[model samples]
Target: MRPVGCHNEVMTTEIAIIGAGIAGLSAASELAEHRGTGEGILVVEAERDAAIHTSSRSAQQLIPSYGPEPVLELTRWSIARLLEAGNYLAAPLAWPSSFVVAGSPEDVAAMTVPGLRTLEGAELFELCPELRVNPQRFRTAAVDESAVRTDGTALVAWHRERALAAGVEIRTNSRVTGARRAGDLWELTLGAAPPKTVRAATVVNAAGAWADEVGALFGAAPQGLRPLRRTAALVTLAEPMPPEHPMVDDAAEDWYYRPDAAGAMISLGEAEPSEPCDAQPHEGAVAGLIAMIERETSLRITGVVKAWTGLRTERPSDVPVCGWDPVAPGMFWLAGQGGYGFQTSSALARAAAELVLRGEVGDWLSPATRDALAPDGSPDQSATPR
Candidate 1:
């Protein structure tokens, strides 16, 4: 209801979020929680619907101890919220699922994390009898009983609902084409038929793969965000897989498989760099995953029921980039979550909101984590590629 510009086709708000994906929706929900009464908030999305990209295509696993220390910390911070998401969701969002990691003796010996229990060759077979690696190749395994399967679609919907309930306006099919800074606000031009404009005091670039492009519209420098393609396929096995079978992953081989209904879902854990676009699964990648699974497991994957690909945008450090742009005032970066977006959504959203509202990292994030995920920090490109 507040109008800052004179044009009739122009709308104004205190904060404008430039994506409807899980990250944007989560940040909008948190910002709504801390916003003052009557303060306007708007979410602009180019897709016809929310969560139509990486959000819905995620593996949807909540593994708190999976990523780097900063990401693990964020995942740890999000566990409570994910567990309590039933209050906001129409149905329960997460279900307990076992996570098992396997590798050679040396590989397993180097793999250490808090609360992970080591398992011997027999123990691994006992846990997942269908696993078919040669006894000699199977050295050791670790189990994280705390892992859970998350409903990615339901979680995004829950966040959208919460943001809407807090009076945040969401405009779909509205793409932002350009942006410029006015006296004290950002003026955004949308790719609408009538060319509508939006004026806001602050803008949060949660555009996932297109985060850097969105920032460039407002003269912000790119943070070297790289969108990578990850391919997955669902295969129907000759025999029914146990519903309670734990999700098994070979860290050294970079492949994982888990039970899905009558079959299993598998991925090669490939992270090939790609341009920002609607991703498509490469037949070779799908076939490669199937081949690896057949070699590593006893299950005969007769046919593929379905296959898909999603983009997981990674930063230079392979950690999420969340915070205000160091060079651009009123512009915030909330992209580069890679594959950990769903697991770390709550904590990252809270941190983004705190940074936008107070211009500082919140207490939930430690000083070390703050430095690692800072938008201004220079990433070491010479390090080994992720």
Candidate 2:
């Protein structure tokens, strides 16, 4: 899960994107494809690299039928599009071997979120041979065909390269100073040389953790966008694990871990309410990861190679705030992807594009996109779903 080369030269486009996370990068690629021009989308990011924040530091996994119902639906639609999005994935998107073990009876019971199954103690051992299933302590195990281990950084670079090919200019290190409605166009003052002014008919705010602060400059309300901190660490493996080691996670999602080339990456998987900004990995969270790993497996983690935290922007209802806003008509709200950005990128960008161009609102949206982005469905399609 690594990139091959460097970025392209600085250029401008018709649509100016605010950030370059998966959401922003995906939007750029879509806008570039839709525009079908050499240069019609310019993405302005504050970070020096494309995905220096949450997009890079994520414990990449595609867990469909997980999270909430609406999010799962989004994940379903996203994975479908991701399959055919032409180079949006790292390698080919493959469903890797995964395991979700339940220790306490309470933990086993938590697995049933409708359409989910709990396995026997013997089956848990069969699913993952290395894992120890204490029938006395741990009750059951859950396995499914939907859990897909992913490489998020590779996915980001994939979209980035595609966007570049489509002439979607991504100017990193160029922070947006201000954005306001000047007549019918958006006047974006960037922090570049002589303060370059970008004028576009539409603007997408995808500033990741800094989404709220950026939206406010353009008269877009905070809309309850909270950038929470999630801490993750990469520990050196004591022994090389098997090829098919399932990722061990919980229902409440207290902690999770996956095997990587370097080692295993463990996540505290916390969503702490914090101020909107670049978040750092908490010290206590690191300790908590070690403890969680110990509880899950007997493997003792003595050396930690590296650790970092990223801010996942969330909205009031936990679902992303996609599409246009009530306050800003032409201005689009593409923020609040939370931790599911990479997995949900394909659907989110498709939703945004359909809303922006054709004013088409599909059933796949979270209802928020329908309310603000498109009132009328596409003229060709039926009003109600078949």
Candidate 3:
């Protein structure tokens, strides 16, 4: 990480990315990989450290069958890329790690996922006996064998390392408070007391929850990004969760639980709308989740050891916003990743890099999928998943 402290002099770069989370860092790494050595790429972070927001807080996973059609495509692509770069991972990222359960076969069929393997009777219980499968609920189970548990910390470090080695500068504690398009370049004002300016040929808005706000600074219209609050907790169960216990998700997408070294990590999986800020967990939400988990599963009584919250910013389509902003020239939208940030990051980053450098995403994605991710694309903003 390069340190460009509070200096009055205006720094210039070929590309400047706002936000140093998984999206920005991964995009930087990808962009740097294809860029000339002399072409400058800068990553600016508002927090003192990168990925301290949603990136570090996620119950890290790479669920290939977990999101919308577009996201699933990206997730599948990312899995291959991550596996190819597995040498950089601290732990093995493999699957049969995520399981989706339903009360009825109809529900399971409705939520059809590619490559989903439906399990039955002893075969299902043998894999995860912790699940309570009765006639009333959790009767059917399916496993996404392609879903992998990702090492979030290691992945972030790998991206940061790759970016730096490729001559990308990452500066922390440099919040972009103002933005203006200066002729052909975008001028971003950072910090106060001694505001420093950064000029770049293009600006990437990967600010996570603050994405829309950052775009407003650059005179771009609101992209309708919603920062939904999600809560998760670590609990002390009467019995320790098996190390191999797979992540169990309700077919309804209401709640999920996975084994953690401490015990088990659980979430009610609510996506309540929230204003962007340092999010805090609600005791009531945690309590509700505990009650639900106990009622639905055979896990014994437990106490919540820790609880936290993170925002999964999303567009109304529940898909990420990639490609150039229609109104703001030289400004690219790389936000609204929602809950599938890490899972689809590699593919999204590659798409972003290609869009930023070559002006097109090529044939990697279907024409409709590419249009769906574009800034001006018509996305169904009617309902954001709860």
Query: What C-alpha lDDT do the candidate models reach, one value each?
Result: 0.83, 0.70, 0.82
Q: Give model 1's clash tally.
A: 0
Ranking by lDDT: 1, 3, 2
lDDT of 2 at 346: 79
Least accurate stretch of 10 residues (summed lDDT) in model 1?
377-386
lDDT of 2: 0.70
Regions more than 4 Å wrong, model 3 = 1-7, 36-39, 88-96, 133-135, 377-386
Q: What TM-score does candidate 3 get on C-alpha atoms?
A: 0.91
Q: In model 3, how many backbone clashes occur?
A: 0
TM accuracy, model 1: 0.91
List CA RMSD, all candidates: 5.2, 6.7, 5.0
Off by over 4 Å in 2: 1-13, 85-90, 99-101, 129-137, 362-386
Model 2 clash pairs are 14-40, 98-246, 99-246, 103-138
Clashing residue pairs in candidate 3 are none
